[model samples]
Target: MGKVKISAVSYTNTLPFIYGLQHSPVMDAISLSLDVPSTCAHKLIQGEADLGIVPVAALPIIPHAEIVSDYCLGATGAVNSVFIYSEKPIEAIKSLRLDGQSRTSNTLARILLRHYWKNETVSLVSGGAEAYVEIGDRTFGKQHAHPYVYDLSWHWQAFTGLPFAFAVWVANKPLESSFIQAFNDALAFGLDQRDALIAELPPRIDFDYRQYLMENIDYGYNEEKKQAVALFLSLMESLEDPKAAESLAKRDLPK
Candidate 1:
Protein backbone atom coordinates (compact mmCIF):
# COMPACT_ATOMS: atom_id res chain seq x y z
CA MET A 1 0.00 0.00 0.00
CA GLY A 2 1.00 3.61 -0.48
CA LYS A 3 2.13 5.56 2.55
CA VAL A 4 -0.73 6.45 4.92
CA LYS A 5 -1.18 10.21 4.75
CA ILE A 6 -1.34 11.74 8.23
CA SER A 7 -2.02 15.27 9.37
CA ALA A 8 -0.83 16.05 12.85
CA VAL A 9 -0.87 19.10 15.08
CA SER A 10 2.24 21.30 14.84
CA TYR A 11 2.37 22.54 18.39
CA THR A 12 4.71 22.06 21.32
CA ASN A 13 2.07 19.92 23.06
CA THR A 14 2.16 17.45 20.21
CA LEU A 15 5.94 17.24 19.97
CA PRO A 16 6.11 13.88 21.70
CA PHE A 17 3.69 12.32 19.23
CA ILE A 18 5.64 13.76 16.35
CA TYR A 19 8.85 12.62 17.93
CA GLY A 20 7.50 9.11 18.29
CA LEU A 21 6.14 8.95 14.76
CA GLN A 22 9.40 10.16 13.28
CA HIS A 23 11.80 8.14 15.39
CA SER A 24 10.10 4.78 15.08
CA PRO A 25 9.90 2.23 12.27
CA VAL A 26 6.27 3.20 11.69
CA MET A 27 7.60 6.35 10.08
CA ASP A 28 8.43 4.29 7.02
CA ALA A 29 4.77 3.39 6.50
CA ILE A 30 3.36 6.85 6.78
CA SER A 31 3.61 10.32 5.29
CA LEU A 32 3.17 12.93 7.99
CA SER A 33 2.51 16.66 7.76
CA LEU A 34 2.34 18.87 10.81
CA ASP A 35 -0.26 21.62 10.81
CA VAL A 36 -2.34 23.75 13.12
CA PRO A 37 -5.31 22.07 14.80
CA SER A 38 -7.83 23.72 12.47
CA THR A 39 -5.93 22.60 9.39
CA CYS A 40 -5.72 19.08 10.73
CA ALA A 41 -9.51 19.00 10.96
CA HIS A 42 -9.86 20.53 7.51
CA LYS A 43 -7.53 17.98 5.94
CA LEU A 44 -9.41 15.07 7.43
CA ILE A 45 -12.82 16.55 6.58
CA GLN A 46 -11.80 17.21 3.00
CA GLY A 47 -10.30 13.74 2.70
CA GLU A 48 -6.90 15.25 2.00
CA ALA A 49 -5.44 13.05 4.71
CA ASP A 50 -6.38 9.59 5.89
CA LEU A 51 -5.82 10.25 9.57
CA GLY A 52 -5.02 13.03 12.03
CA ILE A 53 -4.79 13.98 15.66
CA VAL A 54 -7.74 16.37 15.72
CA PRO A 55 -9.68 18.40 18.23
CA VAL A 56 -12.63 16.61 19.80
CA ALA A 57 -14.97 19.35 18.59
CA ALA A 58 -14.22 18.45 14.99
CA LEU A 59 -15.20 14.80 15.36
CA PRO A 60 -18.93 15.35 14.86
CA ILE A 61 -18.35 17.03 11.52
CA ILE A 62 -15.52 14.98 10.11
CA PRO A 63 -16.94 12.25 7.90
CA HIS A 64 -16.50 8.71 9.12
CA ALA A 65 -14.32 9.82 12.01
CA GLU A 66 -13.02 7.10 14.29
CA ILE A 67 -10.79 7.43 17.32
CA VAL A 68 -8.15 4.86 16.50
CA SER A 69 -5.52 5.31 19.17
CA ASP A 70 -5.27 4.72 22.90
CA TYR A 71 -3.73 8.12 23.60
CA CYS A 72 -4.85 11.74 23.35
CA LEU A 73 -4.11 15.35 24.25
CA GLY A 74 -5.97 15.56 27.52
CA ALA A 75 -6.05 17.09 30.97
CA THR A 76 -7.67 16.34 34.27
CA GLY A 77 -7.36 19.84 35.68
CA ALA A 78 -5.64 23.20 35.25
CA VAL A 79 -4.08 22.74 31.86
CA ASN A 80 -1.83 25.79 31.91
CA SER A 81 -1.78 26.14 28.16
CA VAL A 82 -5.45 26.86 27.38
CA PHE A 83 -6.98 29.91 28.95
CA ILE A 84 -9.26 32.92 28.81
CA TYR A 85 -7.19 35.92 29.75
CA SER A 86 -8.96 39.03 30.86
CA GLU A 87 -8.20 42.16 32.75
CA LYS A 88 -11.76 42.06 34.02
CA PRO A 89 -13.51 39.22 35.75
CA ILE A 90 -15.36 36.68 33.55
CA GLU A 91 -18.77 38.00 34.58
CA ALA A 92 -17.90 41.65 33.96
CA ILE A 93 -16.28 40.98 30.59
CA LYS A 94 -18.47 42.05 27.68
CA SER A 95 -16.38 40.93 24.74
CA LEU A 96 -13.75 38.31 23.96
CA ARG A 97 -11.12 37.57 21.36
CA LEU A 98 -10.18 34.14 20.11
CA ASP A 99 -6.93 32.44 19.21
CA GLY A 100 -6.27 31.84 15.55
CA GLN A 101 -4.49 28.50 15.83
CA SER A 102 -7.12 26.21 17.32
CA ARG A 103 -10.82 25.61 16.80
CA THR A 104 -11.33 23.30 19.79
CA SER A 105 -9.95 25.75 22.33
CA ASN A 106 -11.95 28.65 20.97
CA THR A 107 -15.03 26.47 21.02
CA LEU A 108 -14.14 25.36 24.51
CA ALA A 109 -13.96 28.96 25.68
CA ARG A 110 -17.35 29.68 24.18
CA ILE A 111 -18.82 26.60 25.80
CA LEU A 112 -17.53 27.67 29.19
CA LEU A 113 -18.71 31.23 28.86
CA ARG A 114 -22.17 30.13 27.87
CA HIS A 115 -22.67 27.20 30.16
CA TYR A 116 -20.24 27.06 33.07
CA TRP A 117 -19.55 30.75 33.60
CA LYS A 118 -23.15 31.88 32.91
CA ASN A 119 -21.92 34.98 31.13
CA GLU A 120 -23.69 35.41 27.83
CA THR A 121 -22.84 39.06 27.23
CA VAL A 122 -19.36 38.29 25.97
CA SER A 123 -19.10 39.02 22.29
CA LEU A 124 -16.41 37.41 20.18
CA VAL A 125 -14.17 39.82 18.31
CA SER A 126 -11.24 39.73 15.96
CA GLY A 127 -9.26 42.30 17.92
CA GLY A 128 -9.10 44.11 21.23
CA ALA A 129 -11.81 42.30 23.09
CA GLU A 130 -11.87 42.40 26.90
CA ALA A 131 -10.93 38.75 27.09
CA TYR A 132 -9.31 36.31 24.67
CA VAL A 133 -8.95 32.58 24.44
CA GLU A 134 -5.43 31.46 23.61
CA ILE A 135 -4.07 27.97 23.54
CA GLY A 136 -0.94 25.86 22.99
CA ASP A 137 2.52 27.37 23.42
CA ARG A 138 1.41 30.99 23.17
CA THR A 139 -0.40 30.66 26.49
CA PHE A 140 2.77 29.75 28.39
CA GLY A 141 3.69 32.34 31.03
CA LYS A 142 0.65 34.38 30.04
CA GLN A 143 -1.25 33.94 33.27
CA HIS A 144 0.41 36.99 34.76
CA ALA A 145 -0.36 39.14 31.72
CA HIS A 146 -4.01 39.32 32.66
CA PRO A 147 -5.59 39.79 36.05
CA TYR A 148 -7.93 36.90 35.43
CA VAL A 149 -6.58 33.89 33.62
CA TYR A 150 -9.29 31.26 33.48
CA ASP A 151 -8.09 27.74 32.75
CA LEU A 152 -10.66 26.13 30.43
CA SER A 153 -9.79 22.49 31.06
CA TRP A 154 -9.72 23.08 34.79
CA HIS A 155 -13.16 24.56 34.43
CA TRP A 156 -14.34 21.60 32.38
CA GLN A 157 -13.23 19.20 35.06
CA ALA A 158 -14.75 21.34 37.78
CA PHE A 159 -18.05 21.37 35.98
CA THR A 160 -18.17 17.77 34.81
CA GLY A 161 -15.90 16.03 37.26
CA LEU A 162 -14.33 14.25 34.32
CA PRO A 163 -11.04 14.53 32.47
CA PHE A 164 -11.03 16.48 29.22
CA ALA A 165 -9.56 15.22 25.98
CA PHE A 166 -8.84 18.04 23.62
CA ALA A 167 -7.51 16.06 20.73
CA VAL A 168 -7.44 12.40 19.76
CA TRP A 169 -5.84 10.37 17.00
CA VAL A 170 -8.59 9.67 14.49
CA ALA A 171 -8.75 7.83 11.23
CA ASN A 172 -11.06 8.86 8.41
CA LYS A 173 -11.45 5.27 7.48
CA PRO A 174 -10.57 1.93 9.03
CA LEU A 175 -7.01 0.72 8.65
CA GLU A 176 -5.32 -2.64 8.94
CA SER A 177 -5.14 -3.97 12.49
CA SER A 178 -1.39 -4.53 12.33
CA PHE A 179 -0.77 -0.92 11.36
CA ILE A 180 -2.90 0.33 14.27
CA GLN A 181 -0.97 -1.79 16.76
CA ALA A 182 2.32 -0.56 15.32
CA PHE A 183 1.19 3.04 15.61
CA ASN A 184 0.13 2.53 19.22
CA ASP A 185 3.50 0.98 20.04
CA ALA A 186 5.35 3.89 18.50
CA LEU A 187 3.30 6.42 20.49
CA ALA A 188 3.97 4.51 23.70
CA PHE A 189 7.68 4.61 23.02
CA GLY A 190 7.61 8.34 22.49
CA LEU A 191 5.66 8.92 25.71
CA ASP A 192 8.20 6.74 27.55
CA GLN A 193 10.98 9.01 26.30
CA ARG A 194 9.30 12.31 27.29
CA ASP A 195 11.86 12.93 30.01
CA ALA A 196 14.80 12.76 27.61
CA LEU A 197 12.88 14.54 24.89
CA ILE A 198 11.96 17.39 27.24
CA ALA A 199 15.54 17.84 28.34
CA GLU A 200 16.45 18.69 24.76
CA LEU A 201 13.81 21.40 24.37
CA PRO A 202 14.81 24.97 25.12
CA PRO A 203 14.13 25.70 28.78
CA ARG A 204 11.67 28.37 29.84
CA ILE A 205 11.99 30.12 33.14
CA ASP A 206 8.37 31.25 33.08
CA PHE A 207 6.76 27.85 32.60
CA ASP A 208 7.48 24.57 34.35
CA TYR A 209 7.71 22.00 31.59
CA ARG A 210 7.96 19.07 33.98
CA GLN A 211 4.82 19.96 35.88
CA TYR A 212 2.84 20.81 32.76
CA LEU A 213 3.71 17.60 30.96
CA MET A 214 3.59 15.22 33.87
CA GLU A 215 0.72 16.67 35.83
CA ASN A 216 -1.39 19.04 33.72
CA ILE A 217 -1.39 17.02 30.53
CA ASP A 218 -3.19 13.70 30.82
CA TYR A 219 -2.05 11.74 27.72
CA GLY A 220 -3.95 8.54 28.28
CA TYR A 221 -7.32 7.69 26.69
CA ASN A 222 -9.47 5.73 29.06
CA GLU A 223 -13.20 5.03 29.40
CA GLU A 224 -13.85 8.02 31.64
CA LYS A 225 -12.31 10.52 29.28
CA LYS A 226 -14.28 8.95 26.45
CA GLN A 227 -17.46 9.76 28.35
CA ALA A 228 -16.20 13.32 28.78
CA VAL A 229 -15.61 13.52 25.06
CA ALA A 230 -19.14 12.35 24.41
CA LEU A 231 -20.66 14.87 26.79
CA PHE A 232 -18.42 17.63 25.44
CA LEU A 233 -19.53 16.86 21.93
CA SER A 234 -23.13 16.84 23.04
CA LEU A 235 -22.71 20.27 24.58
CA MET A 236 -20.90 21.49 21.50
CA GLU A 237 -23.80 20.31 19.40
CA SER A 238 -26.19 22.07 21.74
CA LEU A 239 -24.64 25.43 21.01
CA GLU A 240 -26.73 25.49 17.87
CA ASP A 241 -29.83 25.12 20.00
CA PRO A 242 -30.30 27.43 22.97
CA LYS A 243 -33.12 25.48 24.59
CA ALA A 244 -30.88 22.45 24.85
CA ALA A 245 -27.98 24.52 26.16
CA GLU A 246 -30.24 25.96 28.84
CA SER A 247 -30.57 22.51 30.35
CA LEU A 248 -26.83 22.02 30.08
CA ALA A 249 -26.39 25.27 32.00
CA LYS A 250 -28.13 23.68 34.97
CA ARG A 251 -25.79 20.69 35.29
CA ASP A 252 -22.39 21.55 33.75
CA LEU A 253 -19.94 23.69 35.79
CA PRO A 254 -16.25 24.54 36.01
CA LYS A 255 -13.46 24.62 38.58
Candidate 2:
Protein backbone atom coordinates (compact mmCIF):
# COMPACT_ATOMS: atom_id res chain seq x y z
CA MET A 1 0.00 0.00 0.00
CA GLY A 2 2.83 2.42 0.95
CA LYS A 3 6.03 2.96 -0.96
CA VAL A 4 8.30 -0.11 -0.93
CA LYS A 5 11.69 0.32 0.70
CA ILE A 6 14.52 -1.23 -1.30
CA SER A 7 18.23 -1.34 -0.51
CA ALA A 8 21.13 -1.79 -2.93
CA VAL A 9 24.89 -2.00 -2.69
CA SER A 10 26.88 1.23 -2.84
CA TYR A 11 29.78 0.22 -5.02
CA THR A 12 31.05 0.88 -8.53
CA ASN A 13 29.63 -2.46 -9.63
CA THR A 14 26.08 -1.27 -8.82
CA LEU A 15 26.18 2.03 -10.68
CA PRO A 16 24.05 0.69 -13.51
CA PHE A 17 21.37 -0.61 -11.17
CA ILE A 18 21.38 2.69 -9.30
CA TYR A 19 21.08 4.55 -12.58
CA GLY A 20 18.22 2.31 -13.66
CA LEU A 21 16.29 2.59 -10.41
CA GLN A 22 16.55 6.37 -10.43
CA HIS A 23 15.39 6.80 -14.04
CA SER A 24 12.61 4.22 -14.15
CA PRO A 25 8.84 4.25 -13.58
CA VAL A 26 9.31 2.20 -10.40
CA MET A 27 11.00 5.14 -8.67
CA ASP A 28 7.62 6.66 -7.83
CA ALA A 29 6.37 3.49 -6.13
CA ILE A 30 9.46 2.68 -4.12
CA SER A 31 12.00 4.35 -1.84
CA LEU A 32 15.65 3.38 -2.25
CA SER A 33 18.76 3.36 -0.10
CA LEU A 34 22.38 2.59 -0.92
CA ASP A 35 24.60 0.76 1.53
CA VAL A 36 27.61 -1.51 1.63
CA PRO A 37 26.72 -5.16 0.95
CA SER A 38 26.75 -6.18 4.59
CA THR A 39 24.53 -3.27 5.64
CA CYS A 40 22.09 -4.00 2.86
CA ALA A 41 21.75 -7.58 4.07
CA HIS A 42 21.31 -6.41 7.65
CA LYS A 43 18.50 -4.05 6.65
CA LEU A 44 16.65 -6.87 4.95
CA ILE A 45 17.20 -9.31 7.82
CA GLN A 46 16.14 -6.77 10.45
CA GLY A 47 12.93 -5.89 8.54
CA GLU A 48 14.05 -2.34 7.77
CA ALA A 49 13.82 -3.02 4.06
CA ASP A 50 11.26 -4.95 2.05
CA LEU A 51 13.77 -6.00 -0.59
CA GLY A 52 17.50 -5.71 -1.35
CA ILE A 53 20.27 -6.83 -3.62
CA VAL A 54 21.89 -8.72 -0.81
CA PRO A 55 24.87 -10.96 -0.22
CA VAL A 56 23.85 -14.54 -1.06
CA ALA A 57 25.29 -15.91 2.18
CA ALA A 58 22.75 -13.92 4.19
CA LEU A 59 19.73 -15.31 2.31
CA PRO A 60 19.54 -18.50 4.39
CA ILE A 61 19.28 -16.45 7.56
CA ILE A 62 16.81 -13.84 6.29
CA PRO A 63 13.38 -15.09 7.31
CA HIS A 64 11.04 -16.09 4.47
CA ALA A 65 13.54 -15.05 1.83
CA GLU A 66 12.33 -14.77 -1.76
CA ILE A 67 14.51 -13.69 -4.67
CA VAL A 68 12.60 -10.97 -6.51
CA SER A 69 14.95 -9.75 -9.22
CA ASP A 70 16.28 -11.33 -12.40
CA TYR A 71 19.85 -10.04 -12.00
CA CYS A 72 22.87 -10.48 -9.77
CA LEU A 73 26.50 -9.46 -9.15
CA GLY A 74 28.16 -12.61 -10.40
CA ALA A 75 31.30 -13.86 -12.07
CA THR A 76 32.08 -16.78 -14.35
CA GLY A 77 35.78 -16.75 -13.44
CA ALA A 78 38.67 -14.48 -12.44
CA VAL A 79 36.38 -11.59 -11.54
CA ASN A 80 39.46 -9.32 -11.10
CA SER A 81 37.97 -8.24 -7.81
CA VAL A 82 37.27 -10.10 -4.54
CA PHE A 83 40.75 -11.09 -3.48
CA ILE A 84 42.58 -12.64 -0.57
CA TYR A 85 45.84 -10.72 -0.29
CA SER A 86 48.39 -12.63 1.68
CA GLU A 87 51.88 -11.86 2.91
CA LYS A 88 52.66 -15.56 2.57
CA PRO A 89 51.32 -18.44 0.51
CA ILE A 90 47.88 -19.66 1.60
CA GLU A 91 49.10 -22.87 3.20
CA ALA A 92 51.84 -21.07 5.13
CA ILE A 93 49.56 -18.31 6.43
CA LYS A 94 48.73 -18.76 10.10
CA SER A 95 46.38 -15.79 10.53
CA LEU A 96 43.79 -14.09 8.36
CA ARG A 97 41.48 -11.08 8.51
CA LEU A 98 38.06 -10.50 6.97
CA ASP A 99 36.43 -7.61 5.24
CA GLY A 100 33.63 -5.99 7.15
CA GLN A 101 31.84 -4.78 4.05
CA SER A 102 30.54 -8.19 2.95
CA ARG A 103 29.30 -11.31 4.68
CA THR A 104 29.47 -13.41 1.51
CA SER A 105 33.07 -12.53 0.60
CA ASN A 106 34.31 -13.10 4.12
CA THR A 107 32.45 -16.39 4.35
CA LEU A 108 33.69 -17.41 0.92
CA ALA A 109 37.26 -16.76 2.07
CA ARG A 110 36.62 -18.96 5.09
CA ILE A 111 35.06 -21.70 2.98
CA LEU A 112 37.93 -21.75 0.53
CA LEU A 113 40.58 -21.72 3.24
CA ARG A 114 38.96 -24.66 5.02
CA HIS A 115 37.64 -26.74 2.15
CA TYR A 116 39.19 -25.76 -1.16
CA TRP A 117 42.73 -24.89 -0.05
CA LYS A 118 42.64 -27.52 2.72
CA ASN A 119 44.11 -25.06 5.25
CA GLU A 120 42.11 -25.10 8.50
CA THR A 121 44.92 -24.25 10.82
CA VAL A 122 44.87 -20.62 9.69
CA SER A 123 43.27 -18.53 12.40
CA LEU A 124 40.93 -15.69 11.39
CA VAL A 125 42.09 -12.65 13.30
CA SER A 126 40.51 -9.26 13.81
CA GLY A 127 43.60 -7.27 12.96
CA GLY A 128 47.07 -7.57 11.36
CA ALA A 129 46.63 -11.07 10.02
CA GLU A 130 48.92 -12.69 7.46
CA ALA A 131 46.15 -12.28 4.90
CA TYR A 132 42.91 -10.34 4.54
CA VAL A 133 39.71 -10.58 2.50
CA GLU A 134 38.82 -7.57 0.34
CA ILE A 135 36.08 -6.90 -2.20
CA GLY A 136 34.27 -4.34 -4.39
CA ASP A 137 35.71 -0.95 -5.33
CA ARG A 138 38.45 -1.07 -2.68
CA THR A 139 39.89 -4.17 -4.30
CA PHE A 140 40.51 -2.43 -7.61
CA GLY A 141 44.21 -2.20 -8.64
CA LYS A 142 45.42 -4.12 -5.60
CA GLN A 143 46.21 -7.35 -7.44
CA HIS A 144 49.85 -6.43 -8.01
CA ALA A 145 50.40 -5.09 -4.52
CA HIS A 146 50.33 -8.42 -2.75
CA PRO A 147 52.76 -11.27 -3.16
CA TYR A 148 49.96 -13.81 -3.27
CA VAL A 149 46.49 -12.73 -4.32
CA TYR A 150 43.79 -15.36 -4.67
CA ASP A 151 40.56 -14.54 -6.42
CA LEU A 152 37.79 -15.96 -4.26
CA SER A 153 35.32 -16.45 -7.11
CA TRP A 154 37.97 -18.13 -9.24
CA HIS A 155 38.69 -20.57 -6.46
CA TRP A 156 34.96 -21.02 -5.85
CA GLN A 157 34.47 -22.01 -9.47
CA ALA A 158 37.37 -24.44 -9.16
CA PHE A 159 35.87 -25.99 -6.02
CA THR A 160 32.24 -26.15 -7.18
CA GLY A 161 32.59 -25.93 -10.96
CA LEU A 162 29.91 -23.23 -10.84
CA PRO A 163 29.81 -19.54 -11.60
CA PHE A 164 29.64 -17.49 -8.43
CA ALA A 165 26.82 -15.07 -7.57
CA PHE A 166 27.83 -12.77 -4.75
CA ALA A 167 24.64 -10.81 -4.44
CA VAL A 168 21.00 -11.12 -5.61
CA TRP A 169 17.72 -9.28 -5.28
CA VAL A 170 15.80 -10.87 -2.44
CA ALA A 171 12.63 -9.90 -0.58
CA ASN A 172 11.85 -11.02 2.93
CA LYS A 173 8.17 -11.30 2.08
CA PRO A 174 5.88 -11.53 -0.94
CA LEU A 175 5.02 -8.40 -2.89
CA GLU A 176 2.35 -7.41 -5.40
CA SER A 177 2.89 -8.79 -8.88
CA SER A 178 2.57 -5.33 -10.40
CA PHE A 179 5.31 -3.94 -8.15
CA ILE A 180 7.50 -6.90 -8.96
CA GLN A 181 7.07 -6.29 -12.68
CA ALA A 182 7.96 -2.64 -12.35
CA PHE A 183 10.93 -3.50 -10.16
CA ASN A 184 12.24 -5.94 -12.75
CA ASP A 185 11.75 -3.45 -15.55
CA ALA A 186 13.75 -0.88 -13.61
CA LEU A 187 16.57 -3.36 -13.00
CA ALA A 188 16.67 -4.30 -16.68
CA PHE A 189 16.99 -0.63 -17.59
CA GLY A 190 19.96 -0.24 -15.26
CA LEU A 191 21.83 -3.27 -16.64
CA ASP A 192 21.30 -1.99 -20.17
CA GLN A 193 22.97 1.32 -19.34
CA ARG A 194 26.10 -0.20 -17.87
CA ASP A 195 28.40 1.08 -20.63
CA ALA A 196 27.12 4.62 -20.34
CA LEU A 197 27.42 4.41 -16.58
CA ILE A 198 31.04 3.38 -16.86
CA ALA A 199 31.76 6.30 -19.17
CA GLU A 200 30.48 8.76 -16.58
CA LEU A 201 32.87 7.43 -13.93
CA PRO A 202 36.19 9.12 -13.25
CA PRO A 203 38.96 7.83 -15.50
CA ARG A 204 41.32 5.26 -14.01
CA ILE A 205 44.54 4.03 -15.57
CA ASP A 206 45.12 1.17 -13.16
CA PHE A 207 41.86 -0.69 -13.67
CA ASP A 208 39.72 -1.15 -16.77
CA TYR A 209 36.20 -0.28 -15.75
CA ARG A 210 34.83 -1.43 -19.07
CA GLN A 211 36.18 -4.95 -18.85
CA TYR A 212 35.35 -5.13 -15.15
CA LEU A 213 31.74 -4.15 -15.75
CA MET A 214 31.08 -5.93 -19.04
CA GLU A 215 33.26 -9.01 -18.95
CA ASN A 216 34.13 -9.86 -15.36
CA ILE A 217 30.78 -9.06 -13.80
CA ASP A 218 27.99 -11.28 -15.16
CA TYR A 219 24.69 -9.43 -14.61
CA GLY A 220 22.19 -12.09 -15.62
CA TYR A 221 20.51 -14.11 -12.89
CA ASN A 222 20.39 -17.18 -15.08
CA GLU A 223 19.81 -20.86 -14.29
CA GLU A 224 23.45 -21.68 -13.72
CA LYS A 225 23.87 -18.75 -11.37
CA LYS A 226 20.77 -19.90 -9.50
CA GLN A 227 22.42 -23.26 -8.92
CA ALA A 228 25.56 -21.54 -7.63
CA VAL A 229 23.59 -19.35 -5.27
CA ALA A 230 21.69 -22.34 -3.92
CA LEU A 231 24.85 -24.36 -3.50
CA PHE A 232 26.66 -21.46 -1.83
CA LEU A 233 23.83 -20.82 0.59
CA SER A 234 23.79 -24.48 1.52
CA LEU A 235 27.53 -24.42 2.13
CA MET A 236 27.21 -21.25 4.21
CA GLU A 237 24.50 -22.86 6.31
CA SER A 238 26.70 -25.87 6.91
CA LEU A 239 29.60 -23.70 8.02
CA GLU A 240 27.41 -21.67 10.35
CA ASP A 241 26.39 -24.82 12.15
CA PRO A 242 29.23 -26.12 14.30
CA LYS A 243 28.45 -29.81 13.93
CA ALA A 244 28.03 -29.76 10.14
CA ALA A 245 31.15 -27.59 9.74
CA GLU A 246 33.12 -30.02 11.85
CA SER A 247 32.00 -32.91 9.65
CA LEU A 248 32.94 -30.97 6.55
CA ALA A 249 36.33 -30.12 8.03
CA LYS A 250 37.02 -33.80 8.68
CA ARG A 251 36.64 -34.67 4.98
CA ASP A 252 38.36 -31.52 3.63
CA LEU A 253 42.01 -32.54 4.10
CA PRO A 254 43.74 -35.24 2.05
CA LYS A 255 44.97 -38.44 3.77
lDDT of 2 by residue, 1-255 (tens): 999999999998888888999999889998899999999999999999999999998887898999887889999998888999998999889999999998999989888887788898988789889999999999998889989999999989988888989999999988999999988888889888987888899999899999998899888999999988776765676776988666655653322
**For each candidate, how many residue pairs have backbone atoms clashing (under 3 Å)?**
1, 0
TM-score, cand. 2: 0.94
Clashing pairs in 1: 159-253
* TM-score of every prediction relative to native: 0.94, 0.94
RMSD of 2: 2.3
What's the CA RMSD for each of the models? 1.9, 2.3
* Model 2, C-alpha of 114: deviation from truth (Å): 1.2
